[model samples]
Target chain A: MSNVIEVKNLTKSYKEIKALNDLSFEVTEGEILGLLGPNGSGKSTTINCILSLLKYDEGSITVFGKDMKPDSYDIKAKLGVVFQDVAVFDELTVYENIDYFCGLYIKDKATRKKYVEEAIDLVSLSEFKKFYPKKLSGGLLRRLNIACGIAHKPKLIFLDEPTVAVDPQSRNSILEGIMKLRDMGATIVYTTHYMEEVEMICDRVIIIDKGHVLASGTTDELKRLAKIDEKIIVEANSFDSKYIEEIKSFKAVHSADYKERVLTVSYKEGADNLVKIIEYLKKNHIKYSRVYSERPTLNDVFLELTGKELRD
Target chain B: MFVHNFKYSLKALFRNKTLIFWTLMFPIILGTFFKMAFSNVTSSEAFKAINFAVVEDDNFKNDEVFVTVIKELSDEDGDNRIFDTTYVENEDEAKELLVDGKIDGYLVMPDKKDDTPGVTFINNGINQTIIKNVVEEIALNEKIGNEIGETIVKDEMAKGNFNIDIDGIYEKVMEKMSDETNLLDKSANKLDYSMIEFYTLIAMTCIYGGMLSIASINNSLANISQKGKRVSVAPTRKLVTVLSSLLASYVIQLVGLALLFVYTIFALNIDYGDNIAKVILLGAVGSLAGLAMGLFVGTVFKAGENAKTGILIAITMFFCNFAGMFGITMKYITDTKMPWLTKINPVGLITDGLYALYYYNTTDRFSADIINLIILTLVLTAVSFFSIRRRRYDSI
Candidate 1:
């Protein structure tokens, strides 16, 4: 297997907090992997471990089939990172800044120049080439940051919350740019709280909670694993508890509840499930004002697995 | 690694205009201040004139030649005068002048008592300075005349004709006197090598250069050192990043010093003499020492920017200022009364060496200074290497 990054039983802790507990994962060549986790669920910690930025209590990590040390320049040269916080030189103009960081990996002046221009074009920062970070707006700065990071054209890229706090337009542009990078053969390790972003871009997703991997698979596959398949809510002026018992008799009806003048029904999928619920409600003469249904989402899965209490 | 690190570092440093201002232009501004202070005329107008009261007998006061010299000596000029000279009618008048605070001195040319001449100077809580000095010097001149007369007479008697060799005896006496003095005087004017004073100044340059190095390195480390931790996941090594930052700092120091030297040498009319090349070379070494110091601080301090900037500044100031190495070896040049500090300051060593070359052209003070500077650079370099290598980006 051509693995760009690999981790085996990696455990990392800070003080008393076990940030990563026996975490093991790997990224295959040219695959964009989404690392999904709630805050303090050790998403960043795992990335740090994979990058060898943090020393784990157990397990080992290898990048490009070599033992990584702090001074692993060869590995570092092929790696590009855009941190959650914008990291770009404020003093340098956009072009100069890109050239400077790009020059580190590519020695040839002509090649460096070409890569820099390409990066500028990629991020659509050509017009702001001469502007410093201060001169650019928040969105422009974020784009410039991406350009600086990817201009070096590292084989592997780690983007942590790249779209956080950006305007929707810039965020959309950034996401497109990231997809283009993946299309161009750059493997990406992305982390974010936004589920749609993962679903939209990630080839596969890894869901971690409390320093351990809760689930990992394609988004659809992960959704299939969730016990809570669907939810149904009926708002009404009045309802009887006896109707819940009758609704439970229907096929595939796992549970039914009638409380606070409204009857709520949740169940696994089955043929004619909605039709049976309506017939039961009608026979019982429960006047419903509103009704709604939703399939299992990543947010539901996260809320169920990690609990809704704030981590920090 | 070299160019990459240098480029990034340069980019980073230019972001801080405050640091650049203090490190680069401040010194030249200070030098300009000194230039203005030393070059402009120091008006004696600030000081009160010394009052002179001469109790001369009528014999000398009536003499035209003596009166002319007196007038020439105690003269007043445009808005400023050396002394307020008063002619007293008698000793009582002179005493009254002294009592009234009207005069600083009194000179009484008494009647000739000894075979020579006598000049009695009196003062009531006042000094008889100028006139007393003149009278005594006149007496000494007479004594010199007597000696020269005796010599001439003795030589004429010995020789059939009056011809004597002055050069031979004068040369011997001058040589003997020179030998008795300290060696500091040996190359006072010769630029054969760097002088001790020059070495002290070069050391001072290192001290000031260290300011930017420390500031930039610490600022980068504290703010984004963690960024390295994040970057470590890539194909890049932390050391390369560090080296690039250091290289950038070195370039900054070079630029700052070059600007200063250019302005000082060309614009401000500072003379580096034939030692221009030597100054540049020594300056490069000084820049290295400064960068080494910066790297050391950056690596050693893992806390926030406040702590880093504070500690770096403290270290730079302590080492540079304490050694009298930064500017003219302050103690050695101005003879500032800082005994212990000037002795051990390492920055002093580099600056003193360069200063000697640039100014006095004496090399005696240079060897020790160069040795000291080399040792300091090595020590700082070692510190930078060890600290940066061992320090983790997240370690506080």
Candidate 2:
């Protein structure tokens, strides 16, 4: 698929702080590209610059083969953005809010009504269509905010932490709905701090930190970038520390430890690494209750790429 | 898109309880307080006939013309009657009645040749002072007429004209003086000065339109509100959103002004002005100016929302008070001491425009005020528009 959005050498600064530095990326069509980062990792700033809602110091952004600008209505008409903060008129009802926002791009009343109804159903807000924003719960308000942003059926959609502060139920529903949107042939750029969300739906993920792209690829591809290939855990009683030291001497074994009747080992790269560990436990006469092996996850890759520092 | 934006803005603003309260209900309530406070003031109601005590001494009984004039003034059946007078037997009796507050003051007959029928009063309050001035004016005119009649009669005698009617000449002179003065026991409409308060109240109501302008600014700028950011990112142009919201606010403010005008005239029975069309036109223009002033303040001050609101209110009250909303002579003071202020201040121009329309016979002054008010409205609107039009924030 051809790239729908091409951002090259995007740089933005606020006073003395650099928000985005020499950031370059492209989003392919018909794919969910997750822009994953911790809080204050320039995810929102990058999305804003891409949407032309903000000005960048040195960069060029192209959407649908055209340069994006403040007056780029043609490009903006086919774009939808759901900001991190819920943004809907408090005075308007759910249906009216959706309809009013949808009317901005789709002027035809008949078409707008059809689209508004579809959007309401998409977000499952039919029961609360007549409710004001203040009357709705946090989850419902977030849903309503999403409905307002996507009611116009824009081809390119940018969702900035749409599921923040939402309950698990609403988060699942929102994730499912986003997948459905991508299935309907809309290119989406979803930004979030949660690693599970990126692994769940994103076809390709970009892990960013400090205004720089640390790693970008499929979830499995990102996981492959980790130093450890797999983690092996054995719940054994009285496991010998001598065996732990022996396991650490193996070429494939990155590290091994025995604590609290559990023997755990990390491997660098070995398809039979788990089998070898289990054989060793049996040979050493270690009584094991449960034995399990797990593959490296996106969280490990994220932590390895971006240090574990507290960000506000 | 503009129409759509305008429609939603109207729906949203109309439902705002705070906006409605400040724009409509607050003015009506304040107007009620004004009516209750000024209910008994003399200028608030029609002028009533003054009560007087005339001493009936020997000098008073000898003056037939004075007695006829007093009788005519004391008669209740004639429109020429103004004084409710009672005849007392002596100066002590008149003085006793004046001290007892039974009458405004007592009229003493001229005891000396050049006294000119002098009068005295117990207190110089509005009612007592008005009665004293009226009695003294009548007595002085009668004296002058008598002196003129005597002079003319002496000239006639010197020419050997003995057929001249002395009483007729004196009566003719007095009648001419009464006709010219137009204050001789004649019931005429008094100019109500209390209307100035009501005009200032209206000026205040228009200035309260700052609330709408504040709303407009909050709605248009992205830094202040989330709705602003949402609209700014939409496919529609930013200017369209600003203009549409402003138009909606202008329409609501104009309606608010009309309701206040009608309420003051019909419900409160306040005399606004004779020309209804001119008043409405001036009110519309004044409301526009007020709206512009609010917009300018809201745009110029990038402070917090509450701080901006307080600033708008403080500025508006400052202008209204200077225009004499609290004191009637404040406008006069501003006009005299700071004459240039009345010409430039929007509230000053609004109240002065209404004042001119109320009192001045020619539309020249009223037209000038309206023109100045329109120019002020345009200038404020332009300044605020240009100041806020292409504002691209460094950060939102």
Say which candidate scores most in DockQ: 2
The lDDT values for all models are 0.66, 0.81
Predictions' DockQ, in order: 0.27, 0.37
What lDDT tens digits, residue by residue, belong to model 1 across residues A203-263?
Answer: 9888888788888888898888766667677888766666667777877766777788666
How close is every model to the real structure, measured as TM-score? 0.68, 0.75
Q: DockQ (C-alpha) of model 2?
A: 0.37
Q: Which stretches of candidate 2 lie over 4 Å from their true place?
A: A231-294, B40-191
DockQ for candidate 1, please give it. 0.27
TM-score for candidate 2: 0.75
* Candidate 2 local Cα displacement, residue B179, angstroms: 19
Q: What are the C-alpha RMSDs, in order, of all predicted structures?
A: 11.6, 10.4
In candidate 2, the residue pairs with backbone N, CA or C atoms under 3 Å apart (3 or more residues apart, or in different chains) clash, namely: none
